[model samples]
Target: MIERKKYMSLLEKWRDKKVIKVVTGVRRCGKSSLLRMFREKLSDNGVEERQILEFNFEDLSNEPFLDYHVLYSHIRKNLCGDRMNYIFFDEIQMVENFQKVVDSLFLLDNVDLYVTGSNAYLLSGEIATLLTGRYVEIKLFPFSFAEYIEALPDGTPHDTAYRHFSEKGGFPYTVQIANDDEMLREYLTGLYNTIVLKDVVARRKITDVMMLESIVRFLADNIGNLSVIKRISDAMTSQGRKVSVHTVENYISALSDSYIFYPVYRYDAKGKQLLKTGQKYYLVDTGLRNIINGTKGGDLGHILENIVFLELARRGGEIYVGKVDNAEIDFIVIKGEAREYYQISLSVRDENTMQRELAPLQAIQDYYPKYLLTLDNDPVVLHNGIKQMYVIDWLLQN
Candidate 1:
């Protein structure tokens, strides 16, 4: 396994802090692997094996301990009273009344807690209210392009790795199985079904599974386009689907909670008005998108945009789709006092396409860093002070 230095750095900083360390993301995105990596870190640092308590709720051996009370008793019985104890819970949300068990654990003086969950509902109103101000959330994503490169053989060129990254996506397991596309496709399909059935449909108690799948397919089909609940509802109705706007909205929310799709809101930087409607949805991973909708050439721009958006999000940027006047800038990412505007495209070979990609950033008055990222190796940087970068170069950079 390639050591995830970015996430491991976060774990090192938060090690042994009183705050509850919560790791969350879509399933098969390496949450379980991260926990195991951190556990190894603890042992390497001389933490006694007996002093550490670990439970994976997904494991069949722990089925009888599904009750919160039983889980609590098991932990209490294993505690070393004379020393500080570390508790690691994998997929803790599967247990009944888990928030109560977490709250009880928080009251203990000798325990430091870390928990992982695939669904956002795990930390929804109930857990948020119960453990308010006492926990720190650390989000995990699939392999970034940089990590993907690290996992490749020494002779592999950067461009080849990028093609695999775009085609196979950054899922750790998928990257490990690079030689077999069939196995990769099967794995992605199974993961997609598990998330849809277990995380969203079953958890949300939605009776219309077909409608939910239809909406997901529609969103997956159109990643970069502006979309709204009403538009989807009307289209489905026209197609004889007979779903309500409210139901569509509810289903979308459940999908977001499941971490399958992320909606990016529009921010009008020049006008300084936040638009409440018509946001773009980006899938959590491109591999899943390719699996659901066969890998096609027309949507490459949107897929690149989706990958860039997730990369920015993983780096702790507050990302928004920028709408300045009539033109649209691909992303507006802000961190601390620094901000960046980006325009993503597959290629800027045409004069009109080049002008169109550069126009939006030129319209913005701020002198903040502006960039045009594309797949073209010899992109010409225009006079508008925007930096033109190869997407692969940008992906490999810090």
Candidate 2:
């Protein structure tokens, strides 16, 4: 494991707190691995092995707990009398009525609960209501470029790693096994199908699996584009597939719930208003996008933008697609009272491209750190206020 210091720090913050620690992310984005790492940390901290009750619903041995009663009883029976029990439930959402079990265990003073799930639905409607303000959700994403570089061979150049990262993506398992592209693609495809079929379609009782897949693929292929439900509906109709605008929106919601694609709302920072019309969708992993669309030739800029979006999200910022006047900023990340603007481009070499990339940040008229991240080696010195840096270098820095 290439130690994720950021998430580890979050774990330290909520280590023994009363609130439940919920880890959520896309399927195979290393949520389970993060739980395992934390469990090891607990052991290293002298937490007794017996006091930890680890249950993975994905494993066949735990299938009996699919029923809420059995799950509750099993947990209740496993509780230690004197010591505080640390319960680590991996993919807890797989069990029906899991909120009841979580709520019940949370009521006990002797238990510190940590749960992992692949989708946002793990904290959806009822679950959110049940654990309202009583839980802290720590989102996990695939490897950032820094983590990606750390996983690569020692002799690999920064450019090589960046290219591979752009092409293969930052999915942890995929990054680890670099030899077999075929196997990696297959695994990503299967994971995507499982998330769509089991988590979204099956769990939500969605009737149109084919339409859902089509909409998902369209979104994946068109990352960073302003997407409107009506446009999506019309496009699908033109392709000889019938789907209502509302149905398309519902499918998009399902995808978001499953953590497959994250839609970024446009925030007009200057105007101080949130726009409701158009939004951008970013894939959890570019590798999965490649799998869905078959490694295409163009759209490298959008892929890079998606990577940066997820990275900012992993850093625990509330991200928005920033719109200032007619110019657009790729992301505006706000944490507490601090905010930063970012623009992502594959290259700012061309004069027009440089102006286009810097225009949004220049228009902001604020002292906040504004950056333009690119793959170019040449240092750009345009726009007195905006900072220009290589994306990989930026990722390596704090």
Candidate 3:
């Protein structure tokens, strides 16, 4: 297994601090596996098995502990006096009033707590309010391009590995079946359905399942394009399926909360403000997008853009679809005082196409770094002071 060094380093930095470590991500993104791996790390570092207590609320046998009192009592009994204790709760959202248990345990001086949840709701509850400034969040994503490459067969060429990664996406389960296209499609489809039905519809008490599916289709069909609720509603209406704008808004929020789709707002780079209208939505994984909507075959342009967007996000960039005057930059990444602008395309082979991609970055007056990423094997060179990079090369560099 490839070690998730990025997340592990974050956990190590905050190890044994006076804060709860909350790990959250979409379902099947390996939250449970990460907690297990960390637990093993603890054991290897001389932490006794008895000092570390782990609970997976998803197991039916753990149902009795879903009550806060029961959970609190169980862990309190397990506490051997004196030494620090590590507590891990997987899918803690299954527990009723779970925040109470966490908040209560946190009062103890000898306890270090960790939890994994499937949605943002876990962090927005009364527990978050109580623990304000006392917790750190580690948002996890599916395998990245670098992680994906680690699983490739020995001696696979870079282009072949990239095509597989781009086509099958970076989900761990999909990687196991990377060579089998048919099975990967079926697996992703099942995973997507479970996320929608269990995570979104069931949790949100949504009654219009069909409408939700329609919206999912619409969003997947138009990834990385400017969108709004009214536009979504109108598109559904034109297709003979009527949906209200308010309903569309709620559905979109549900999708976002479930971590299946990510919404990127448009930023007015020239004005230095976020634009209120015309946002873009990208899926959590391109393979899932391909299974649901055949996005990979139809528009490699947007697929490349979506891949770049997720990579930027994985590197912890404050990302936005950038708008400068009449020109649009694919992404604007701001980290502290440093800003980087990116324009992504299939290739910058044509002079006109390169000029089009370069115009927006050139229009910006700031001296922040600018890049134009593409699939061409063009030598890395400066065109009008903007750096050009091969997208695959840039992804692996992270």
Candidate 4:
């Protein structure tokens, strides 16, 4: 397994702390793997096996312990000594009213708890009220380009590695079948269906499964395009499927809550405020997008943009699409007092394309590292202090 140092470092910091460590992401994004890796680390560090109690609710063996009382009793009965007992629960959302069990276990003096879930419901709604400020969320993603490269066999050429990484995406399972296109596609399709059927449709009790699929396809086809619920409703109605704007809104929320698609709101760069109407949605992983929407040659620009969007999020930046005057910037990332502007494209090889990509950043008067990233081969153009970089180089470096 690739060492997910970023997430492991976070878990190490929160080790034995009073707060619950809540790991969240979409299905099969490697939450359980990370927890298992952390368990191995703890054992290597002299923590005894008996001191750690781990349960995955998805496992058939754990079905008997799904009841809150049974789970609580199991943990309570297994307390080995006065030393801290680390409890790792995978897919805690599978258990109904799990917050009560967690709340009850939290009262124990010897327990240091960690839980993983596929949806935000574990932290929002009623659970939020129950665990108010008592949990720290560690959001996990499939794999960063850096981590993806590390997972591959040693000494693979960077170009070949990058092509495979972008095409196959960072899902760990995909790495196992990277060389087999048909097998990888089948795996991704099955994974996508599970997320839709189990995470969104079944969980929300959405009756219109066809409508949900339509909305997902629309978002995948129009990645990074400004979207509104009414517009989506109208589009679906035109296709002989009538869906209310309200229903569209609810479905969109459900998709986002499942971590299938992320919504990035527009920000007025000059006004320093978020614009509500022209919000854009990006997929959590481009591999799923490509599989669901059918791989298209024309969508490379959007694919690169999606990759950059996920990279920004993984780097802990608060990202927004920027509108500066009549021009739009692809990304405006604000992390702490550091702000960076980015415009992503397939290439700025042509004169008109170069100016179009640079216009928005040139219009901005700030000096906070504006970048125009593309696929150009190191043709450095330093226009008014804005640095133009090759996208692959930037991804590998940062």
* Best model number under TM-score: 3
Instruction: Provide the overall lDDT of each model, using Cα atoms, as 2-decimal numbers.
Output: 0.89, 0.87, 0.88, 0.90
Query: Against the hidden true structure, what lDDT does model 1 obtain?
Result: 0.89
TM-score of 4: 0.96
Question: Compared with the true structure, what per-residue lDDT tens digits does model 1 show for residues 284-345?
Answer: 99888888788775678888999899888888878889999988989998787878999999
lDDT of 4 at 285: 91
- Candidate 4: tens digits of C-alpha lDDT, residues 169-263: 88988999998999999999999999999999888999989899999999999998989888999999999999999999999999999999999
| Global lDDT of model 4 | 0.90
lDDT of 3 at 170: 87
Q: Which runs of model 1 end up more than 4 angstroms from their true locations?
A: 379-382
TM-score of each: 0.97, 0.96, 0.97, 0.96
- lDDT for model 2, please: 0.87
Instruction: Name the candidate, 2 or 4, with the larger lDDT value.
Output: 4
lDDT tens digits by residue: candidate 2, 1-398: 87888888798899879999998888888888888888899899998988999999999999998898998898889889899899989999888889989999999999999999987878988779989989999888888888888898888898888888878888888876667888888888788889889889987789988888899889988999999889999999999998898889888998898888899999998986789899999998888888888877788889888888877887777889999988899999988888999999999889999889888888888788899999888665546878898887877776
lDDT of 1 at 326: 87
User: In model 3, which runs have C-alpha deviations exceeding 4 angstroms?
Assistant: none
Candidate 4: deviation at residue 95, Å?
A: 1.0
Model 1 clashing residue pairs (backbone): none
Candidate 4 C-alpha error for residue 55, in Å: 0.7
> Model 3 — which ten-residue stretch has the worst lDDT?
289-298
Worst 10 residues of 1 by lDDT: 376-385
